[model samples]
Target: MHRSRKADAPRADRVGRAGSGALALLAIAATLAGCQRGSSETPTVPTTGPGGCPAVRAAAQAAVAQAERTDTAWDGPTTGPAAVSGRTVVFVAETMTNPGVAGVANGLREAARVVGWDLRVIDGAGSPAGIQAAMSEAVTLRPSGIVIGGFDPGSTAQQVADAAAAGIPLVGWHAVVAPGPSSRPPLFTNVTTRVEDVAGISAQWIIAHSGGRAGVVVFTDASVPFARTKSDLITAKLATCAGVRLLAYENIPIPDASSRTPREIASLLARFPDTWTHSVAINDLYFADAAPAFRAAGRKGTGPPFNIGAGDGDPSAFQRINSGQYQAATVPEPLTQQGWQIVDEFNRAFSHRPASGYVAPTHVSTAANSAGATTWDPPGYREAYRRIWGR
Candidate 1:
């Protein structure tokens, strides 16, 4: 998080600026609280050419077109030690309710079975204390390895240290800021697409789809550093388009998303009735929660407030995209393939080899190319991993 620098000013001027800032904050708070009434008119989309930034629009269109391609080949690791058989593993989930976490866990289970390893999963129930307790239990179980699934490892520092002290190799799925081996948190490797690519392409999608003239709202979970970072990058990219207006930056935690999103969406509809042209969420679940609110507010399923999830393209996201119900696109991670990668990373550890350091490339999925699929299951990864493991 970079902070903007301010020049020195007089005390009186500073006090005046502080007072204005407070008023602005109160106004925003009132809008979010559903106290401010908004217009009932739907936002009008502009059929314009890159909003006067032709070069940016052209680059965005090219990138989005490339990302939407469905014929990407397997580019992950193809060589390593064969499976380390008969080992037991445990996956400590941030919350099974998060489709991303659960999806990866399922992939891990499938790969584990193929590699002939026993696997156990413990649900953290999406609480700090619950995750800590889960981590503690995983360390005590003394499994061959422990997976930090979709939660910050720093939050459970003691448990992670205990696992490391016990010589248990730790692998993470969206666990740390960066992918591939971390020294501070002690992860053998982290499985995730590069956050910058995901964020950049997501924003570019909005630019290309809207012809660089979108009034965008970005939703993110501030509690998770990774989610927050992605949202920030998305905001930065959206700023590149001169005609795109950032209507709002909503911070709704993932666990609370199901409960809070409906009210938030209703409020946003009232507040920015004609200006909120598009939305980009860090996860797709927000749109699922916002569906009823949108319907109640008389917003069409195929909308002016077209939504796109920046990451975690789960089955539900695909359904919404395929049906043209609120969501228009997603930058989906190869969840199942990542799960297989986790197991493969563990095998490398067991074989006394280095982490694969493989980060999946970013891809965007939309109605035109989705082909009625439920998830973005790219081809060749399963077979490639199988051959690498000699299964």
Candidate 2:
């Protein structure tokens, strides 16, 4: 059985946070515009810094080389509780429209079928009130377990507390900052690749692709702590390569990305037309939203401003990469695999076993290696989980 509802209007407070981030970016653009008025020459990217970029670029290339490998054996847990039969679970999603959240939901749905568990999904529609309401309803259902499917558990503290009081085991898919059991929010386990690994490789991709000299813009949703942290790490990593100039840090919220991205892209183009050589965003969807504006600006699909998403490689992102659209590469989470892990974690909780401390290794996908596939579904995980569950 499945149930879902549309979220109401966003909470005023979250909207304000999103707005402040956007306003800061606009102010940055305005200031840059004033500074560049007399200069017709493109700013030169510094190639020879204190140590020069050759060593850094070489190291980055090697790290990227390892991450791009598609043949990695499954490193997740090989032992776990066998399937607990006839259980019921609820998945409270941030929004079905978010590819990462939806992709994980699809995976969980598949895993639940394999495990013979009843499953329900409630869409939070990308708003605080909606997410809170969805969490409240999820707790009210008294399901055997609840999956916090991509929103911060802290935001729904009262409902989370209620579920905890009821002794419902909770699992999370990117619900917290870390990947293992979270004591603070009482999640059995949180499934995700390490954000530092994801962020580092993404910046390294740009460094390797550009041969160490490029001007870059980073896009992030400040409204989500996970996203903001990833983008901040990306910024810090990019700083290591002195040749890579940080042009702008655009803070467009994920929910408002489609409506605001085109306009922001236009502003970025006008502000740093010649120097902006690359982009990295916290999510792949930003590139999807920026495509039209790039087209209008006469930027080629094969771009000087090569784009890479730091996380969540959805079908659309793969299509863009394979077709040489706006995106060049992505550091994608293994969404389906993580979904299967979520079910596995819940099973462990149900069996009174300890949470599996497995974290998926970060991966980077590019046009050269993607081979036209959609999601970054790693091999052996499905078989491994099935083996563990004795299915």
Each prediction's whole-model lDDT (CA)? 0.80, 0.81
Model 2 agreement with the true structure over 1-391: per-residue lDDT tens digits: 0012222222333223323443343343333322221102122333224543888799999999999999999998999889989899999998898888899999999999999999999999877899999999999999999999888887789999999999998998887666788777888888888777788899899999999988888887765666755665676677677677878778676767789899999989999999999999998999999999999999998897999999999999999999999999999988999899999999999999999889899899999998789999999999999999999
Question: What is the Cα-based TM-score of model 1?
Answer: 0.87
Tens-place lDDT digits, model 1, residues 196-245: 77888998999998888888887877555566566656766776677777
What number of clashing residue pairs does each candidate have, in the order they appear?
0, 0
* TM-score of candidate 2 versus the correct structure, residues matched by position: 0.88
By summed lDDT, the worst window of 10 consecutive residues in model 2 runs over 1-10
Model 2's alpha-carbon lDDT is 0.81
lDDT of 2 at 194: 73
Over 4 Å off, model 1: 1-50
